[model samples]
Structure formats: C-alpha cells, structure tokens
Target chain A: MMDFISYTCLIVGVIFWFWGTIPLLSERSVLFKLHSLSVSDTLGSMSIIFGLLLKIPREWPLLVLAIVCLVLWNTMLGYVLAYCSSSGEKRENR
Target chain B: MVGHLIFRLTIWFLLTANLSWLNILIGLSISLLLPRGYTNPETLKEWLSILGKILWAIPLAYIEAFDLILRPHNDEDMVCEQVEKKRSHRLVFLDILLITFTPKTIVVKYHEEGWYEVHRVTRRKKP
Candidate 1:
C-alpha cells in the first residue's frame, strides 16, 4: 500500500511539472507563464517531498523542513519576480 | 516572554528531532539568546480561526489549480474585473499567497485607489 501511494505521488508530481511547462510554449503573457510555472512547480515539488516523507519516516524532520522551505521561498520568489517585472514596465511607460 | 521562549525551544526541538541532552542544552541557549519578537494574540479564538482559514485555503488552492490545469478555458470566470475596496495588508498578503499558490490567477498590478489588476487564463468571447 505504501509503495503504491509513494509511486502515485511521484507520478503525479512529474505530471504537474509537465503541466506547468506546457504554457511556456504558447504565446501567453509573461506573468501568465510565470504563474503557471511557479505554482505547478511548487506543488509538484511539495508532493514529491511528501511522498519521500512517507517513505522515510525516520528523516521526517528534514522532509518537513524541505516542504516548509519550498512553500515560503516559492511564494516569496514569485512576489519578487512580479514586482520586478511590474517596476520595469512602470519605468518604460514613464 | 517565558512562554515565547518555550515555544521557540519546542520548535527547535521539533525541527532537529533530537532528544539528546547536548541538543537540548544548545537549543535552550540558542532560543534564549535569540531576540524576542513574538506578538501576543488578542484571543485564542482569533488565532484558531486564522489557522483554520489557512488550512482550508490550502485545499481550495489545489482544487482551483487542478481545475485550471485541466481546463484552462475556465480562467475567464475566475478573473475579477476590478477590486475597488481597500483591503488590509494582512488580507491582501493572504489573498496574494493563496492566488499565487494556485495556477488560476496571477496578480498583474496594484493600481491606485485600491484597485488590483489580476490576469486569468481563460477563453474570450468572440466579437
């Protein structure tokens, strides 16, 4: 049962990663692409980490830490990227 | 202050997952040495409700994300035209975090007069 769950999580994580990338090839706006990529990547990474946590309960502390770091850093990075992109637009418009 | 110190030490212990005397000693000293920055909550009920909201937001985010990824055309309904009312900093931050965590919405800009421009990936109506 555990093996099945672990494999499922890993598979889903990989699928999400690919799902996020599909937008990059299209002619969407930069922000749209960034949003799709970042959110999917974060969720994929988290799901994989969670699978690992289940597989290796002994190292749960580190795995949990990894999850927290992924969540906090990914969100912060997105905000920073958006801010920088917006500010550049402002300078160009002025 | 004592309560804060204990909370910090407990977190340290949980992160390390070590129960050795040396680990405890080091954690105790480190926690004590760290600057005090914990803010007292007005009420436990308020804190619990905030935590509950966050917990609920996580699942909602996943549902929205999956829907967007599977059906990208639904983005039109998700996107808001404009938000005229001012939101508190805390609320704005939470909304941004929740929206960004999901693939459905991306905050484009914060225009003047409390207006927020968000972009959603959805199909447009043909003229």
Candidate 2:
C-alpha cells in the first residue's frame, strides 16, 4: 500500500509540473503566467519531496529542510523578480 | 517570549535530530548565546500581532482560491488590481509571503511611495 501511494504521488507531481507549463504558452500577462507556473511548480515539487520523505523516514531532517526552503525561497524569488522589473520600467519611463 | 524560545528549540532539535545529552547541552548553549533579533518590547508585540493576522489570513486566502477556481462566475475574466500605499517594507514582505503561498494572488509590482500592485483573480469590485 505504501509503495502504491508513493508512486501515485510521484506521478501526480509529474503531472502538475507539466500542467504548469501549459499556461506559459497562453497570452496572459507576464505576472499571470508567472503566478500559475510558480504556484503549480512549488506544489509539484513539494509533493515529490513529501513522497520522498515517506520513502525514507530516516532522512526526515533533510526532507524537512527542503520543504521549508522550497516554501520560503520560491516566494522570495517571485517577489524579487516582480520588484526588479517594475523598478527597471520606472527608470525607463523617467 | 517563551513561545519564541520553544519554537527555536524545536527547530534546533529537528535540525540536529539527536537526543544525546551533549547535543542537548550544545543546543541549549548555542540558542542562549544567539542574540534575540527584537529589542523593543512594543515592536515585538506589534510583530507578533501581525504574524497572528497573517496566520489567520492564510487559510481564508486558500479557501478564497478554491472558490475562485472551482466555481463558475461571470467575473472570471476580470482581474482585481490593488495598490497598497504607505506600507513598510516588512509589512510588504509579509504580504508577499502570505499572498504567493495562496496560489491565487500574486504581487505584480512594487513601486515608490510604497505602492504594491497585486493581481488577484475574480473581480470583487472592492479595494
């Protein structure tokens, strides 16, 4: 049963990763594409990590750190990218 | 606060993942030696309150996301734009931290005068 669940999670994660890319080809605004991509990507990666955690219970320490870093770093990177683009645009309009 | 110390200790234990007496001693001493970042009691209290608000807001935000995605509505094509002004950097950071995690809202741009342009799906017609 555990093996079955693990494989299911792995497959679902892969599906999410590919699904996120579908939005990238759309004509939506940059931020909209970015939002869909990042959110789905993060969720997919987190699901994979959780599956690994289940597979290797002894490696809880590293897995826990991965989860925390994934949540914090992804959001920070998104904000930084958004801020940098806007600031650059402001300089150009001046 | 005791809660803060306990939280740190819990993280320390999780990182170390060993319950030996020497490890405990090391963790205790190191945590004690580390400087507490907040000095002002009032500021700390204010930060704690803000944190509480963020925690409370997170679940509601996710619920809102689910409603927006799963329900059919006429305003599906509409995007809500919000320009928040006069916000401190810390507050803005906290907002981004909470908003991005929800999977429905995103911070598009932040500019001078503390204007934060956030893009959210579903037109609520309210700022």
Candidate 3:
C-alpha cells in the first residue's frame, strides 16, 4: 500500500543520514563518507520521490522525469563537493 | 562479462518503470563508482567521503563551539589557557574547527562565569 512504500523510503532516508555518524561506520576517510552520502542522497531521495509518485494519480512520465532530474542534480552536487574537498589537500601540498 | 551484462539487463528492466529491479541496479552502480585503491584521497570514493564528513560534522561542530578562552588539547579542540605566563597555540577546539575548514578570523567574547561564545568569523588560513 501507499503507507508501506512511504515508510520504506523514509526509513531508508533516516538510515542514510545517520549512517556516517556511527564511529568507524565506514573508513575514517572523509571521501568515503561523502561517497556514501552521495549514494544516500541520490537513492534515498529517489526512493522518497518514487513513493510519492505512487500516491499521485496518473502523470507517470512526468513524475518519473522529475525523479530522474532530482537524482541527476543531487549526483552532480555530490561530485562537485567531493572534488572541492579533495582539491583543498592538493592546494595544501603545493 | 557477467557483471556488465547484469548491469545492462538491470538498466533495461529499470526503463520499464519497474521498482523491483531499481534498488538492485542502483546498489550495484554505487559500488562500481566507488573508488578503490591505495588508502589515500586519490579516488572518487575518498573525495566524496571527505565532503560527507565535513558536511556531517559542520552542524555538530558549530553547536559545540564555545565563545571564550578555553583549555587546549592535542589537536581536536583548539584552546589554550595561558600557562607559566607563556602562551602557545595548543590546538584549542576552535583552532581545530578553524583549521578543519578554511581559515577565518574568529571573535570570542568573555563572560563573568568562565564562559565564551563565537561572536564572529573571517578568512582562510594555512592548512
């Protein structure tokens, strides 16, 4: 049902947000954490959006497109942020 | 070989708007994109993780920051109490916060009850 879908997506989002907080959850590498979060943001958001789409009436194509765009945008942001943080180290080394 | 075919097949199934195969495909893609190599910030995974930690830590760190002169520790929190009438940058909490991000001018105000708060901030510093 709609309730099941929504809950599943939301629970996953919460898990993604809380994932890095655990000590030694992944490696200590900040880059790894960012990588994990990128997955979290993209797929987590996708899950939530997809769940919402199911609740709506018709317009399947539009909803799917919207979800795709959201995923793409979030992925891009993650990429840029990841690069910026690592580039800092390069600058420091120079 | 097998992985590539599976990945492509998953994508084909996904195009049909099938949710069943979506999660599986996304999980695999994430794993593939993750950087693998020497334990350095040379890969995409390492880079993303760093940004993640910084973004994650910011709110918690800003909340914990104090607004006064405080004791210094190894390198986490940058605080230094004047000892033996000699001063040293003992890596106070704030200092660590400052260096952790970009450099900045931080303003601290002192209160009567051994307390302080971050009042202001400014520019980049040598990392």
TM-score of chain B of each: 0.54, 0.58, 0.23
Q: Interface RMSDs of all predictions?
A: 2.5, 3.0, 14.8
The prediction achieving the highest DockQ against the true structure is 1
lDDT head-to-head 1 vs 2, winner:
1
Docking class of 3: incorrect
Task: Give one digit per residue, the lDDT tens place, for model 2 in A1-81.
Answer: 887787876776677677666778878666666566664666667778888888878889878988778878987777777
- True contact recovery of candidate 2: 0.47
Q: What are the per-residue Cα lDDT tens digits for candidate 3 across B4-98? A: 34545455444555556666677567556655433212345533554576566534332322211022111212232231222122223223233
lDDT at A53 for candidate 3? Answer: 72
How high a TM-score does candidate 2 get? 0.69
Off by over 4 Å in 1: B1-11, B36-43, B74-95, B107-119, B123-127
Q: For candidate 1, lDDT tens digit of each residue in B22-126? A: 999999999989886444333456445556877886677677768767666523432444543554454555556655666566665555566556666665554
The local lDDT score (0 to 100) that residue A87 gets in candidate 2 is 69
Q: Which tens-of-lDDT digit does each residue in B37-127 have in candidate 2?
A: 6532335665787779777864564455345345522222323345456555556667667766666666766556655567655645333
Better of 1 and 2 by DockQ: 1
Relative to the true interface, what fraction of contacts does candidate 3 keep?
0.00
DockQ versus reference, model 2: 0.38
Which scores higher on DockQ, 2 or 3? Answer: 2
lDDT of candidates 1 onward, in order: 0.70, 0.67, 0.44
